[model samples]
Target: MIEDKNQQRTQLSDLGEFGLINHLTEHFEIKQSSTLKGVGDDAAVLKFENKKVVVTTDLLLEGVHFDLSYVPLKHLGYKAVVVNLSDVCAMNAQASQITVSIAVSNRFPLEALEDLYAGIQTAAKIYNVDLIGGDTTSSTTGLLISVTAIGEVEDEEVVYRDGARPNDLLVVSGDLGGAYMGLQVLEREKEVFKVNPNNQPDLEPYTYIVERQLKPEARKDIVQLLKDLKVKPTAMIDISDGLSSEIMHLCKASDVGCDLYEEKIPLDPQVISTCEEFNIDSTTIALNGGEDYELLMTISQDDYPKIKANPNLTVIGYMKASNEGMHLVTRADTRIPLKAQGWKNFND
Candidate 1:
């Protein structure tokens, strides 16, 4: 029998903060050996051996970062954790632990929060990261989530954004623009829903793009693949804020220029179709669309041979001298200056 989602709704006041915390986190077991001490303590105790530790944190707000009307609690929780882990992977590290803190208003039922934690637990299991400790608190308005991911990497294996040189090859893991296209689809459906509450959305056609936006997987496998291929990236960053924005970040940090090939930028078939349906430029979408969570890295020219045959990666561009200036070479051979037009959370 199908479970009724609304059949059992418990108020937040039914379980106080402490009781709620224990109830939600009871299922998480310690799986990481680095975790000396987990939950139910003043603080989490961790021990990293000889390798260097890397920590990354992210804050997700209801209206600012996400919309509950379309985003399910579970997917939000998973995405929240995955985004932080993506940062760790960008450094060529293995994420081992996470601390998830959440604040929710009284409007949310205990079951809703359980759904959120279910997603978090699933992400922790799949990513192989232990949820050590976190805090649960009350919020006056909407829900909020904060996640901190910790990982380890050898000193020599750590990759930074400022290491790209003039001759380094710019490579990207997976295609871009699908997530942004997915957001467009969701927003359109949301608008349609507002007009006709009884209408069901036909999301089957946009399943791939929708999943790209709602549940993005970090490039953890890409990191391991790079290691197996013996390809050490000179510089790297997770593509959270569009390819153009990330490329600019790498260029500014490394004091170099880039020549991104418009034809070479990868785009999923769904992304292309959606762009056409929306009357938007596919290249523009790829450049400015954000939240792909793919690894953007610069590898040495000598390492090109190793990655050339790798289906998981694509060489989109090549770095150049700072004096050359960053430009996008059009398919027609026209060189146009590249600009960052990614999302600005503060602009609205």
Candidate 2:
């Protein structure tokens, strides 16, 4: 995130609020037919006559949610949108539109915001979600982004965290631990840069994990894949706050206990190798390392056959009676109580 000494700087106050909004949102095209009125209005207009709608909002602060030291504005913009879309995907819904509101300090220039909006537009186009409406205002803080994602789902197709039942098979989309390890790599490089500014980081070996942290994609495909396979999840939640934390959330909401097999938790080769390099336990990283953005779900045993061969999904474990309690069935055949030690918003 190095800045050029001679780079052009167009002041935000010069364009004014309305001019800035219009300039930033001018290039965003409406992709969803449901979006009747997009940017330029006080509030967005959307229509979903028969289908059920799902709305999710996420607020990302400058220092709290992201550190601009290593996080690019464009990547931050894209990540802000994807995080909310991941929430929609967890509901088994099709994301149709999003309203992005940003608050920035006086130090930011118009071109910097253009780069941020460029990432937002790229995400909107790739996800096929329309940019509806939002508010922009001056902030004393660095930068804050709040994205509200709206999605559509069939009335009966909508899944919740409480639909899981005893004996249901636990499933997860894609591998874990990469994002957390990637963050470790970035944080290390950031520290290194402080000590030696001219020493360039050799991140070639950590490309996969690094990308997993910087440009993670929401598992929107898993929802459609389940529909195509005629497999409806009994319960669903996206893996944002780590696997153990999300599993506990699902289990508590469903009034059931889970046996998350340690052996079954998917770990990419890069994640495993990096964990060893860091001298950190891979299993612990998989359990507590947050922001995977993969979908975690439960399905009936009857539906297992349909997804058994699919490479996109991995059957991790099974649900049990609530009295049995949530636990991790270790590789050594030992059972231990599962704990929620992932991301805490109010942590001091």
Candidate 3:
């Protein structure tokens, strides 16, 4: 049993499925106008008026996608929502509502589930999204969370992976490699704890990166920033599967090639230092380390000046003709084929 003395631990069987759902979701109030009907329904009813609705779903498993030893249930719930919202934002839309479903083993108490919902509530409040509907069920193994996010955008404002054109500038929002390096630090600490269970890890130095891994926010601001700047991305995708893999996905979908500059890829100072401490290449980490939740997009040259001075965005490279192929130009001036080594659930 997980230790929590303040709250009384209750068994799942005591409340039953419907009772448990009501107890947990009682506080979640519908805040979106599009949500015509939310919880306590056979299915959620939504109305989008003249706007185009965007929907995305993601499933996170306990051992495969996350480690409970180092991860908090609240942070896990927030992340589960954010990852799906990131997908909706990738399409340049404003997320309005989310449906969360969880499968949990009997080992988790009602209090533990409350902690998880607390996180879900926090994220909903911060992102301004409503918890429209969801389901809860029993699991024999561990915890699994599935979130489906719904968003809205005008038909003209929506961006897709296939809309990029040749000569468009490749821009990325915020920094990279920090989340991947943060995972490395957490994994190392977990190993240390396994060997000596009493060891107290000084995680202060790795706080930024660790938080980047554990509690990443989607790039919702980038969408707003783009709108404010009156610039529309020709193509866009969120960096959930690492920079290299996501870039390749854009290229393939748009039928174009790219020249990603290794020197130009943004890296946080902590990521660089952590890479040195671990003797791992920072560029490789940036390329293959996924789950940053930042936005990667292509913009026409005409729109370049608008974003040129923006500190939150970085222009890393440019789209090329399909014949050029996708390659990364290293700091040494050597060109290598860009490769995708993003997260693979099957391999895990």
Candidate 4:
């Protein structure tokens, strides 16, 4: 029996963003002595007196984070590790080990599990991280993977969201927006396949970009390089939420402002061409398109030469006083206030 819609309950939109977060999390409280802070920042920080530990976990669902139709089991396994490791790297800590938990339905066979484990082993080897423990369980639905990563750092070496100082140079590792473009290419091909299954996708043209999306290499090397170079980023975050959103995080957490240049945002030639092919603004893609998994950070101006000379790094902008503003400066010399367009699962 259908009820009167006019007499129905309150909508989620009526609660708004902060209201939802508060309502959902209000019931939970930190119960562990080691838990320094929880669910309030980029990553949960824990202290053990002599040393500090950073803990982060991520859950990737079958249809949401990936589509098995196009993604290989091996790549899926590796990506599962990469996503969690990316978070540890963002905290400016070296990942040491991971615990992988999988929940799979009866549809997946033993051979498929072996293939997935093989990929996980490969990623563990590549990152020099140990797979210490995990849990395997049955599921009523599709595949679900959860990974919890652990890393250690000296109490002084740990960097958090609330550390950015004014005048720091905002930098990022590698290029941006390639992953979004890659997804666009894959989705277009999937549509083509739906129309006609026999048509082979010309994925060769987008190998690099597609790989960027499918099996991204974690920026573990960059974290190691920063340690070797003795450059501690004032504040740091990863690019999973799009550049605009991440920049806002750094600003809000650190009580600072930022000025990012449109031109300085790194873009590979392939990404530029792909954006043109799709008739989308590359700048917009870099700003709001998510899941690049690159490092977004700020360093001291004196440390600029260190990051500047490195081919792996790109100086895209600078931090400013909190009262100034956070914005993007276009090539036309127009300055527009920055805004976050982060991806939302609920909205989709």
Candidate 5:
């Protein structure tokens, strides 16, 4: 909410467009053999040889998708790449390359972009992906990032949302609802800061939820773990929207319904406690709270033995005929129709 008046700031105009791009990307190293030419060329050149390729792209706006007051530029940059890569992972593929493009207002200094690129570089190194090519330009808006991620997978291993069948088990990786609760905490703190600038928020109790909102990691490891366990999902989707909407997506795509057990939906202790403090239902947050980024899929019942003992996976329900309809089976033995009340930007 406040900027230091005495701190130095460098304008972006001093380096121009090309120079700025070069300066930001100079430290990015090419780690993938699939990348023939990266960064400097007219366009990135990639050869996947005999492997099939998967491409996923996402655009995030400043005001619409993020708030600079809360989100650090580095985390924003890292998250922009991770979100796209998660889509590739949803297809059961190995992420190999990414192209990052950003539009920013002249108010951003060159150092600010350095922080953003540093985060991008860190993600590239940590995820073992190559930063190939992208474009940068001026903008009237605060900041926006567009990332296109490229991944490689074998033809037989590639999974789609239409492969789920009746009698398959619904499973999810990691927990849910933490990210939404984290956002709630941040929003509350932001309001408090507005009232009193000297009031420093004590976020010690909300550390898990805050990190969930700020820096979310894609489930790339789960993809590899599935391969090692010799279990391929029948239908898969990342929980970017909300559990209900994503579940509905899978059901519609595969033409099958589901009976999601409320008790079985994985949620962290932090989420439950925060929900109590805010007077919101934990189950509702788990269903409609978006940005969990966990993997949700249907697995053949025969393959259930493989993932059963794994703590990372949970079997929450089973798929049924579409005529049966989608419902959430409550703890008291009530079956309620599921609804998509998650993040719908267009509605706003």
Candidate 6:
């Protein structure tokens, strides 16, 4: 019994980063001709009729990705789909189908699963995506959800992270940083609950911020709107890892640079107020907080008027020569170096 127990206790840390990736893929055999590529790029590339398809997945684990104390099951389910769809939209493709796999502890009853699935179905209908298949499993700990979304686009219409050209205008849809600030509010409420178990947290005032955190919408409409307007993004990425980190990704992949205008960073008023309440810099939160699920893209300079004329888009900056580096021009008329403060799960 002792020997068996010892053999089962394999620490994940023993295989770090590349070691883990190699270990996970070691036994996986590519058995399908349709799987043109797998597991080694921004998105899995697949060859189809006369077009290409991209498939990507994301996993969310309770306690790590979310706290059940504040996150309702329904909202959690909706968010899982939203995050995966964001990745599909990042590649400038229409997300058509998704498979949702979930593992939950026995503590949750059938009704709880129904609540979760309700949100999933709602998202499917809203995004006009189909739910093909998935699996359910039992877990001894908290809940785990893994979602794989499949999308397709014509070969030429597929905008990738590596295609930004110099002189392209950088634009973002909606606002940033509200979700991060909303998280701060939820955490504070959780702390308060710990101190006074009977105190019902008054979160009525933080409706916008709370909603931003709990239920983020993927920019599917933006994709359709852009197409209707005849605007083709040179390169694109979803702002799931914060603006600064994503900008760096586009810059590195395109071998270009960016100069973002701080004054132009679209931020919600509630995010600004919440940042003030928490004594956090709104600009920093907007740049590094992540999880806004907004679209970040670069368009040709000639298309600037198209984006400018439309109220839905904001021109934050533009791509430049690689040697220029990424800089943020503040409203104070000062230029500051942009830094990527993306979240590191290892620190947790």
- Give per-model TM-scores: 0.98, 0.98, 0.98, 0.84, 0.98, 0.85
In model 1, where is the ten-residue run with the lowest total lDDT?
A: 1-10
Off by more than 4 A, model 3: 1-7
- Cα distance off (Å), candidate 4, residue 241: 1.3
In model 2, what lDDT does residue 274 have? Answer: 95
- lDDT tens readout by residue for model 3, 261-343: 99999999989999999999999999999999999999999999999999999999999999899999999999999999856
Q: Which portions of model 6 show Cα errors greater than 4 Å?
A: 1-49
lDDT of 5: 0.93
Each model's lDDT comes to 0.94, 0.93, 0.93, 0.82, 0.93, 0.83
Model 2 C-alpha lDDT per residue in residues 1-348, reported as the tens digit of each score: 344444889999999889999999999998788989998766878899799999999999998888888888888889999999999999999999999999999999888898789889989989999999888999997999999999999999999999999999999999999999999999999999999989888999999999889888999899889999999999999999899999999999999998999999999999999999999999999999989999999999999899999999999999999999999999999999999896667875
lDDT of 6: 0.83
* Alpha-carbon lDDT of model 3: 0.93
What lDDT tens digits, residue by residue, belong to model 1 across residues 238-312? Answer: 999899999999999999999999999999999999999999999998889899999999999999999999999
Clashes of each: 0, 0, 0, 0, 0, 0
Q: Write the per-residue lDDT of candidate 4 for residues 1-348, one digit (tens) a residue.
A: 111223333444445444544443344344434456655465555655566778899999998888877777888899999888899999988776677778877676655655577777778778866665466667788899999987767777777878889999999999999888998998888888889887877788788899898888889888988988899998999988789999999999999998999999999899999999999999999999878899998999999877778999999999999999999999999999999986688787
Alpha carbon deviation, residue 346, candidate 5 (Å): 2.6
